[model samples]
Target: MRLKVFEFDISNSVLINTQTQTQHHLTRTEAQVLEQLANHPNQVMSKGQLSCAGSQQAVMSESAVAKAIFTLRKYFGEPYIDLIETLPKKGYRLNISTPPPEWQQQLAQRKKLIILASCMMLIAAITLITAMHQYIWFKTAESPVRESRVVTLNNHQQIELIWLQSPKKSSQQVSNMEQKIITAFNLCPIVKWRDVYLAFSNDMQVLNISMQGYSSNGELLVRNIKTSDFSLQPNFISPNWLQEVSLCD
Candidate 1:
């Protein structure tokens, strides 16, 4: 590995100055220790870790690591000797002046790619959130508002009605009409009908009535009641109104 002016031949235990072509042979222990320090350039490694890296045994004393560092410094000589720095009560660090040029370039490229990928992910997330918000708003604008109520008839039959809100109809008037319809349903027997959906015109007149349920043979059925099909008089409901709205018939 090349570090500044020196080329460390870790496999052959040799260190050579590229400028002067001066070569220095190193011990196996010294080469292992140097390999560890060069691999982690500018980082501290404890004496015990360095010692284990060089020694063949399971454990080696810190003195062996210290001796290797001293020998390596003597070989490095004047200006380059201080490359290995010793910290008080801490550990040793190989203070590489500058990392290898190719390595530095690779690091820069990796960092740029990471930043670009993060920006793309952030943009995609924002776009998805905005699209979902627009979809929800569009659906809300397209669908009409409805008011739902559950009513129990005089005959103790329970039914749920979902009515579309009308611009001209007051809530109180709608409630009165809904109660009248519920009472009229009791005037005739209905089977297999429970949910009703009612629509109203802009002028507050009834538009349509749709009821849904399963038939006697377990088939799904929809019964529709039109405004012209039933009569709602000022003082009374027509006798045939219940028959007109009956699901069974």
Candidate 2:
């Protein structure tokens, strides 16, 4: 039977067969060592050079190279030096035409499939982990509710008010006030508030107030008062009417 060897692309592995079309695959390291042997056919390759070329790191100990050669021999079996002939202290050479047993070819194919499956699973796991991390970051990154308030300057004068709620602290009273203000007026008006003031109470309550001008030349003023403020009203819609009413015109 005519023996043939084929080299694989991008890896140090090879396929060898005798007459039959049956194929076998080898790891890159195994293939590189085999190719070196095929070149000399009957000349031994230096253990040092074989280790360096066959390894991913471009260098390996002599003992490591020898172990790899031994494994290859055990797998391929006779006529193949069994294809490698060891020259003790000298190196190794291929006897060529070394064909593996029919049963072994099937076993090798199964091993390759297992390796491929393992790699695919690892990639999937990494992708899933990354997605989970991003989702958690998005969930914890920002506040869900916005805060706003309105202030009446006089019996005939009233203005719309709005502000961003502080994420640092909160209270049910402040929460109710925020809802009332939002319900009473359109928040985030197109016009800019003229003067802005920020205030805070010992209870961690915060207040933001601003004054804006309406197209009618009328003035619009607003305040965002936290319910936590002790000075807040029972309605809590406007906390400490006087203290929270800083002008923002």
Q: Tens-digit lDDT track for model 1 on 1-249?
A: 986678999888999988889999998778888888998888898887788784555355688789989998887878888789998788999989564599889999999999999999999988888989866555435456477877787667778888876676667766776776776677656546688887766644455678887777889888877664224423122446555545444
* Residue runs of model 2 more than 4 Å from their true location after superposition: 1-12, 19-21, 54-58, 96-249
lDDT of 1 at 169: 61
Q: Give the residue spans of candidate 1 off by over 4 A.
A: 1-101, 120-156, 164-168, 189-192, 201-206, 213-220, 226-248
Error of 1 at 193 (Å): 2.7
Residue-level lDDT of model 2, residues 135-185, one tens digit each, is 655554464225444554323244444444454544664555445543334
lDDT scores in order: 0.76, 0.54
Q: Pairing residues by index, what is the TM-score of model 2?
A: 0.31
Q: After superposition, how far is residue 193 of candidate 2 from its true place, in Å?
A: 99
- Which one wins on TM-score? 1
Would you give me the overall lDDT of model 1? 0.76
lDDT of 1 at 69: 94
